[model samples]
Every structure is written in C-alpha cells, then in structure tokens.
Target: MNGQPGTTRAAVVTGADSGIGRATAVRLAQEGLDVGITWHQDREGAEATAAEVRDAGRRAAVQRMDLTVLPEAADAVDRLAEELGRVDVLVNNAGVGTAVPFLELELDDVREVIDVDLVGPLVCGQRAAQRMIRQGDGGRIVNVTSVHEHQPRVGAAPYCAAKGGLGLLTQVMALELAEYGITVNAVAPGEIATPMTGQEDVDVLTVRRPGVPLGRPGDAREVAAVIAFLSGPGASYVTGASWSVDGGMLRMGPHAGSHLESDSWRRP
Candidate 1:
C-alpha cells in the first residue's frame, strides 16, 4: 500500500526460510519491495533469505515465527511490519502437513496441522489486513495453498481439510476485505522441489512425474513467480481466486483414476 505515488512498500512472507517462501521473498524484493522473512526452526535459512532480498537492493527483516504457538506467534507479523516501516503485501506461505492415515491419525497431530496450515494464516491475515486498512492504502494477501486444496490425498486427511477450508477462506476474505482495498487470493501448488517434499536443491527437470502434465516436479521459483504477480499491480483486478501452479496435476484426476492398474494409489 505504501508503494502508491511516492511512498516505499514492504512485504512480509511467512516461512521464508526456504522453498517457495524463500523464493517468493526474493522475487518480491526484485519487484521493488522490502521483504520481511520468517522462519520456524531454520534461523540460518531465514537469514539467507534476508540476505538474498538485500542483494536485490531492498531492505530485509528477519523474524522467527512458530505457527503452532497460536495468536502469540502471529505477532511476528506486527514486529516485521514495524521493522519494515510499512507492510503493503503479506504472503502466508508457512504450512505443515501429515502423512498419517485418517483412521490412525491422533487428535494432537491433526490439531497441529490445522493450527499451522489454517488458523495461523487466519490470524496473520487479520494482523496484516488491519495494518493495511489503517494505512488507508490498498494491499495484497497471497495464501500459499496446495493442489490438495481442490483434491484429496489418501494419507493427508488433515492437510486436505485445512487446505480446502483455506481455499474458501480466501474467497471470504477477498469479499470482506474488498471494501478496504485489500485483495485476497490463494496459490495452490503441486509436487514441487522443496524441502517439504524432501527434494531441496534437486533439479525438478530431472525428476520424472508422469502423472503431471509437465512430466516433472515443479520448481519452487515457478510457484513464486505466480505469487509475485498476484502481489503486484498487474493483478490489481484479481481477487478471491485460487491459482494452480501444479504443472497441470489437478487436471489429471480422471485420467489418473482410469489409468491406475493397481491399488497402490489408494495407500499413502
């Protein structure tokens, strides 16, 4: 919002220590916005992301955020906003998932996933939107969802539920925030080469994924590019929409269902 006529702007990207979060922070920096980087357990990775933002000739601030900590943990957004002077964009990129079967899932684990993936973003978005409203300038909020937001996986019941809820939450936020000149959207990513997928530093092109239309795993930067666009002026008219950055994975649902020769896809 501060990037109006003559003011400077800043963006806060949660879980920016690595993967898509890190890439988004750097990309937003390249687009002429100072970046606030957050990490949970990877302080070094957060610092590295901040350095990348700085190298892009933009200011960078680092903060440690534990989404599991609830309302208190979301305070990192305010702290980063204060450090950066103004927050014009917020990327809710931090998330967690589980592989436990639904029937075997412990209540505690399910709660943890929901807390990190859904509640955390809800609170963070509130904090950021409040600041943007007070600033009286338009702002952007991009939620980093997953392809599971639209489809479900066998062993990720909580993850799917949280993401599905978030996809709708994005629409509600967009509608409610529109009056305040705030745009809300979600970016759903598929199999990407990231630490979350245990594929950090691996070349996506070399990893074959026949089910995906792209025939390979996606790169974190590829998702970041779409996020950056949604966070910028070019996407001013876009709101409440969920963009899929899955290399066409979501489109293969029926195709995959019919091609599967065994029950392997049924298991986690």
Candidate 2:
C-alpha cells in the first residue's frame, strides 16, 4: 500500500460533478489523496469540485469522459495514472437514474443505463486491476451502487437491473483480483439528498414513507464516509461486500406506502 513520495494515494472518481461523487471526491482529498474527477456534461461543475479538492491542499485533475464508449474507458484510467503518478483507489461512482416503467421503457434507454452503470464500471475496474497487478501493490476498487441493487424499484426498471448486475460484478472482481491483492466492494445508498434526486424538493421526514425507518433522507457526506473507509487501510479485509447505507428502506416490505400522493408537494 505504498504510494508515490509526494502523493500518498491517487483516486479517480467518475461522475464527480455533483451528488455522491462530488462529496466522495472532496472527502478523499481531505484524507490526503490527490483526486482525478470525470464528468459527462458538467465541465463547470467538475472544475468547481476540482477547486474544492485543491482548496483542501490535494492535487486535482478534471476530465470529460462519456463511459458509453467502452474502449475509451481504459484510456481514461491510464491518463489519470499518468497525470497523478499512480492511482491507488478507483471509485466507480458515475451512474444515471431512470424512472420509466418496464413496459414503457425503450431498448435504447435501458441500454444507456446499463452502459453507464454496469458496463462502465466493468471497463474501469479492468483497467485499474491491470495497473494494480503491474504495480504489485494492493489496491482498492469501490463501486457506488444503490439500495435498488437488492430491492426492486417500481418505476426504475433499468436502474435496478444495472445495480443488481454491478453488485454481482463486485463479488466476481473480489474473487478474481484476490490473487493480485486487489479488494473490490460496493456501497449501496438509499435516498441521499443530492442533485440526482432534485434535492430541493425532497422532504424525507415530513413526507414520512413507511419503509424508511430513519424518517430522513441521507446526506451525501454520510455515504462518502463509508466509501472512504472501504478505500482506506481499515477495510483491507472487506471485499465482495455490498454495504447498504440506506435508512432501513430495504428492510421494510409490503407495508411501505408512497409519500408522493399530493400533486401540490411536487417541485415546480
């Protein structure tokens, strides 16, 4: 687990322009890790995140990466490693959320979700694994999954499939990469107050859904803390595990009721 002299660890966080990815990048930088950030269509937001990381006294690099083109994925990782010297941790946090029902969902939409959420991670993981093996140093790969990886969502057919596939992919990676001393795991979070969910309109507690026992939506920082652990030394023994950060939302069954009954409560 030795890092380069000036840089202890270099981390690459995809979809880091906002939400969980942004929070995780900042947190990792605070922990003394130089970070490489990627954005799909938010260069401004990505640069803003890079500024925050630099303000924390960690080096930051921002790049634009569209993960759908699978071949380009390895090159992105290679570029990050070259720029930052070495990458000791890779956080696959880039993903898209879709709310269309299965029947209404088109093949293209489903493919897009899978390409970003599942296939993109696979491509990144492969590239990182090769580097870790070459470095002959133990490395970490943490995938930012969702509670839907285990529980099905009513309107998000494609998202659920992608996460579920990613959950299994994590385990497969852990098994295969153990020989190379690489640990792979996942962090499945529930309703986090982030731009991904239109945070300004969400009132987790007052809405009072039956399933979420905590009666509140989680903050991105909360999930980032767990991710930081998995990436650090403490979680060396933890691999192939999907840690659920949801507030008991997945635990409640049939009894959970919809909190979005009133049209007036919706965001304008």
Candidate 3:
C-alpha cells in the first residue's frame, strides 16, 4: 500500500509472449495495472501483448530475456521496474518442459529445466522484493507452476522435479519475505490450452483421462484470473500456498506398473 499514490500499479510478467503468461499480462493490464512483458524468443508475440496492454489504456514495456541466466533474470526485473516506474507485482511464469523418460533424459536437459524453472524465479523474485522493500510498499510474487508439482508424470520427470522444488521454494519465500511485506504464492495450472502445446490438437473436454475430474483442459484466462486475485489486494492474507488449478488431476490414485495410453497434453 506504500506504492505511488496516484500512479497506476505496475506488474512484471516473464514469458509473456504467449500462453498463460500472455493472458496473465493482458488480464493484469485490464485490471488497471501497467505491465512489463518479457519474451524468451517471441519478440513479435511480446509486442503484440504490449499492444493489447496499450489498447487497454495501460502502459507496457517489452523485453527479451533468457531465464537460464540468473543475472539476466535479475536484470530483466530491474529493467522492467526502471522503465515502468514501479513493479508492484512480479509473475514468474517462464518455464520449459520436455516429455522424455527419466532414464533416457539427458543430464543437460534436466539441468536446463531446473535452472529455468527454479533459479530464474529466485533471481527475479529477489530483485523484485528488494525494490518493494526499498519502496516501503508491499508486493506480490506469483509463480506459475504445474499440477506436476504435486503429482508425478511418467514422461515429464524433469518438469515434475522442478515444479515440486518450486512449490517448496514458494513456501520458503513467503516465510522469509513476510517481514518485508512481500507475499509469495504459486498457481499450479493443470492443462491449459495454449500455443506451447499445439492448441489445435488438444481437446480438454474430449480427452478421456481418469485423473482430471473436470475432463477438460483449463483456459489460460481462468488461470490468469486466479493470478490476478493473488496479485491484487484481495489476497493480502494469502501467502506460502501453491493453489492447484489442475481440475482435480492430482487427486487421482497412482497406479504404478500399469501401461497407460500416451496422454499428449502439454503445459503452457
């Protein structure tokens, strides 16, 4: 609440080129927050998201950042805050996933996923918290996680491991940052329809999976709405929690040694 009194609230969202990140950026802008959008490789898409933010009558700043580099992640947050004036919210939504068997997975690939999903968020969150504390205002940090954070996936060993670690990390951050008035939380989305997974081929409603009770893939906006709640004033008391948006996917029993059909759902 110690942020600029008359200036609009600002947020920095990484991986905002497309999918959940893009949708969250637009949604935050619509909610009257200026947004700083970052893209890993999709400059055009990031610009498009910025355009939408501008059209919403909010300020937008777009940047290119590779999350694998910790310095770059911290630098991006600093740059966003410098350009946007202030960052009241930071969304760690950038991540990578691969569908390789655990035994067959390369060490390099596993390390890459962990670096992006874990270390990257840590760097960005630390930078954001530093600014928030210095400004004497409270801030929010929302980590975009996956259902795999609690539930394991057969072909997605690295993703599950990274997300599980991220879940714990969120809790630790929430506890440590509490004194600074910064809240840390996570949104673990199940299956959201986004470009990261070939959107055309995914039928969330039609996919007959025994796990997901909703029997449908979630929409990016749905996840974005939850993130908005946490980023906004309503969730001031909510911290150190990873809200699962997986439509009950993690509640299913684990049937090991059972041969299951390839469920080609991808995380965005």
TM-score of each: 0.95, 0.91, 0.91
Instruction: Find the candidate with the highest TM-score and give its number.
Output: 1
For residues 126-210, what per-residue lDDT tens digits would candidate 2 score against the true structure? 8888888887787999999999899888899899999999999999999999888799999999988889877833555554544
Candidate 3 C-alpha lDDT tens digits along 14-108: 99988899889999999999999999888999999999999999999988889877676679889999999988999999999999988899999
lDDT of 1: 0.92
User: Could you list the CA RMSD of all candidates, in the order they appear?
Assistant: 3.5, 4.4, 4.4
Give Cα distance to truth, residue 32, candidate 1, Å: 0.6
lDDT of each: 0.92, 0.86, 0.86
Worst window of 10 by summed lDDT in candidate 3: 255-264
| Runs with alpha carbons beyond 4 Å of true place in candidate 3 | 200-211, 255-268
Candidate 1 scores a C-alpha RMSD against the true structure in Å of 3.5
Kindly give the number of clashing pairs for every candidate.
0, 0, 2
Decide which is better by TM-score, 1 or 3. Answer: 1
Can you list the residue pairs that collide in candidate 1?
A: none
